[model samples]
Target: MRPISTDLDQALALLQAGELVGIPTETVYGLAADASRPDAVAKIFAMKGRPADHPVIVHIAGRQQLADWAQDIPDAAWKLADAFWPGSLTLILRRKPHVPDAVTGGQDTVGLRAPAHPLTHALLERFGGGLAAPSANQFGHVSPTTAGHVYNEFGDALGLILDGGPCTVGVESTIVGLTDAHPTLLRPGGIPAEAIEAVLGVKLIHHEKPTTAKLRVSGLLDSHYAPRTPLLVGPLAALEAEAYQRFEAGQRVALLHHSQMLQAVCGAECHAMPLNAESYARALYATLREHDGDRFDVLLLEQPPQTAAWLAVNDRVKRAASGWLA
Candidate 1:
């Protein structure tokens, strides 16, 4: 295993040789492998303990390489790519016959994205193929927002980690299923669904679960993006009450609030989260990872407003919370 570095040649060499590299993206760090190699893709699943049935997104340099991995290229996909490529947006299309089943979970459809990170973009161009990458963390855990976070997940096991600093978006891409007549919103993430809808000139079908086809996209599981410590979400009043009770019981507790202030309790840590939606989304995962482990017995979060702007954050919070405090 090697230390984290910004060397492009080393990252490319490892990927080309069918090894894993922790690569950065605007959204989150990805444990990247050559998407064309089933053997290499299998290593990602084994390393993350991710299920074989779960698919990983193939990160390409740009839309020009879309034809190499997918077939039945649709006009909607092109429009979305034109509008959001080199950013946080993933398009799901029919997979080319050559695309490894290991990358698509034996499904006919493959997920594709062109990451906004300059380092990863250059690496993809040099590699000249799609890199199958999921969030650089263990399966069902909180996604990594920095090279250090990636290192925490895999440590010295990964050959190289391209440190591109902290991720700006700090969440996964907004996934759109373009295989059908209408584009379906499989996951709301860095890119808002409303913004994607404005591009397509039609409303997005918000399908929490793809029932008809049973399509599985990344970050769609019910208990995804969770932390090891017990986390609960609710109003500030409820959370503050819970924190006080826990503190009085001589238990370690942490409260994450979006409001201006929370009634502080002795022996409990209170963290003020970003009030703005974008800032909150960017800081959410890293904050969770920071306070997790033996530092606290439980984490209490004040649920953000249920608005379109905070949709992605709310979704992640809801999934991450083990239960709700009334």
Candidate 2:
């Protein structure tokens, strides 16, 4: 396995030479490559088994460079950037002529964000360009929230993994599309939609369905962020009952719950997840990674609340549970 460390210079050198590196971000670790180099960007898709047409978010050092990649940035985009950049929010806007199609998934618009992670921010400043990055995990799998997670996923496939500890926001960025006249919520993520709305002073249009032919953005897939183990999400009562049934059937169940109502089963592994939204988001992927490593027969996750604060958590749980729903 490639060494994981805090050497930003080594990572920058690798990226400049058209190689891929695992980068730390406040939201999650990313499999990063030079945005301007199609060859480098292609490595990201190939390494992650990601589709060539699925867009990755361009991580910039700061918002000042937004105009360099995206054109016709609306006032709403600027407002949100001012309020949330260097944080967990991504703006999908009109792509400039120079922005590569590989980065934009052959679309005319691109997703861009300025992550608040200090190491990645320093690397971006030194690299002097946008880094096209997707979550540092295999396609349709749970995202990596730590350097160790990234190393476990890619191993020696990546040139380097910048060790920046655990990601503060355990989910992906909140993606908002600004290509249209009005801002639309493409995905709920680290930043709550309600917070963005307060900054923009307008109700953001929520896109309920997955990305269609016209609308293409990251993290809009139906069955993404899944574990190899089958996962089911529902009410606490339902999950507990299902757990008992699975245990009776000679299956070893793993249960992740936010409620204290359910007690541990004799033959099953049980984890009490944080009930608060931020704490829950922070621990979400880590818990999934841990359970995934254990090779449980079934992973039962209790569904989060439907309120705005828990929207991002709910979104992740639903996606992670999608594969077993049928």
Candidate 3:
């Protein structure tokens, strides 16, 4: 396999020619294509095996380009953009007629954001248009947090992957829907929901269940961000019992926990996770991706605390887990 390139000129040329380039964002690496070119954007869905109706977020340089892709943007949308633009927040607003149905999932609304990663920002600036990008991984799998992760997903099939190092935020952007009368939290991510609420000066209408959400958005599916191996999430005691049973039965079990493994379950590989939410979020996907596949028959994760700080981590963990133990 050829090494991933850091050449912005090569990335720009590829994107301009309506080809897919794996670009890095602070949140995660994205499979990007020129948003204005429907043919270019369609390649994103095709490569990821993403559903045609699922919308992809268009990454712009900043809020100044908002009008180019969306229309009727509300004051609240502007406020949130002011606070979080060039960071990790995605705003859903009425789409400009020129915006392709493929990008908007045939909906009137479009998802837009200005990613904070310097390399991708420069790429977007030089490209001088929105880049329709989704997590550079196979559909419904763990998101890529580094250029290597992106390479692992699509090998030489992807020509250029701008190596921007590992993602700092390590999760998708927080998606807020402003098309409704009230600002709604479509997805919780790098930015906390409370922070957005503070900026808007109103509590966001939190949509807990992605399945029931009227408008489609990225990372909201019930079984998304999952790994090939079966993952079970539950209380530590419950997981330990199950891990012990599995180990005794000659199964390869990986025990992931934030707390110390007081009782050493023989034959199971125990891995400690970051205790704090921020560090945990940064490490989540990479950890999952590393231990996934033939190494372990099953992964038993001790559930994190149910609190606001852990909201994004909990959301991803819950979706990734195949089941829960009592």
Candidate 4:
């Protein structure tokens, strides 16, 4: 956790030279590269060990700059932009042909957003164009919410780590794609599905699972946002008893729960994240990272409710615990 310099000059210099840096966003920290430069964007995939088929989102400064990257902006998209721009909403639109295919993973459409982070907005304003960036963690690892999480995952791969405190949203953007101007929800994220429906006055159709699914934004992989330590997910009561049993058996068990009761149940061994959606999303990655190391064995996440707000959290947790119980 070195005191990161928010100097735009040095950051843009590295970007211009086709290098990668860790950029902050309200949702999470992103591994950023020059979007227009194919070689630079390629480094992003290689560094993260991300699959080529998984496309990245382009970071734009504002709605006005959308023309540079996207060719077809739907009317519904305009509604979304006007309502949620400069926030955590990513729109998938037809690319303008100038954005590298490598950046879009050969998809005809590219994902674009104007992140609501001051440091990143300034960088995008000065650097120009867009940056093809994804969560600043190795593919399938827990997304970084803090600068230390980025440093832990990246090690020495990153040149600049812009410390913008902690991400406010703490999850990826709510991705909506307009293929035929029929807005589709490609991913559920920081913004809830119900909120978008309320705005559009119509429920967004989830992208057909078997087709037109991944042609939208990044982080839609079947498995992603994982942690190094194995996480056992279920009711907090079930997980709580199991954690204590494991701990008593001399196993280094880490407990991730929304309930404060379990915080003292494990004494100093248990870590409690935020109870609400916003704080929970913001604290998710860092909590995983904190428990991944030292004094922990199998991690147990006290499952959140199956409400609309918990959909994205459940998706991420299910992915992280993919191979653990199965």
Question: Which candidate achieves the best lDDT against the true structure?
Answer: 3
Task: Give the least accurate 10-residue stretch of model 2, judged by summed lDDT.
Answer: 317-326
* Most TM-score-accurate candidate: 3
lDDT of 2 by residue, 1-326 (tens): 45798998899889999999998999999999999999999999999999989999999988899999999989998898899989999999999998999999898999999999999999998988999999999999999999999989988877799999999999999999888877899999988888888898889889856544268888878888999888898887787788899989999899888888635766678899997999999999999999985578889888888787898888888878843321
User: In model 4, what is the error at residue 98, expressed in angstroms?
Assistant: 2.3
lDDT, candidates in the order shown? 0.92, 0.89, 0.93, 0.81
Error of 3 at 51 (Å): 0.8
Query: In model 3, which runs have C-alpha deviations exceeding 4 angstroms?
Result: 1-3
Better of 2 and 4 by TM-score: 2
Supply the global lDDT for candidate 3.
0.93
lDDT for model 4: 0.81
Steric collisions counted per model: 0, 0, 0, 2
User: Where in model 1 is the C-alpha error above 4 Å?
Assistant: 210-213
State the lDDT at 211 in candidate 3. 60
Worst 10 residues of 4 by lDDT: 207-216
Better of 1 and 2 by lDDT: 1
TM-score, each model?
Answer: 0.98, 0.96, 0.98, 0.92
- Clash total of candidate 2: 0
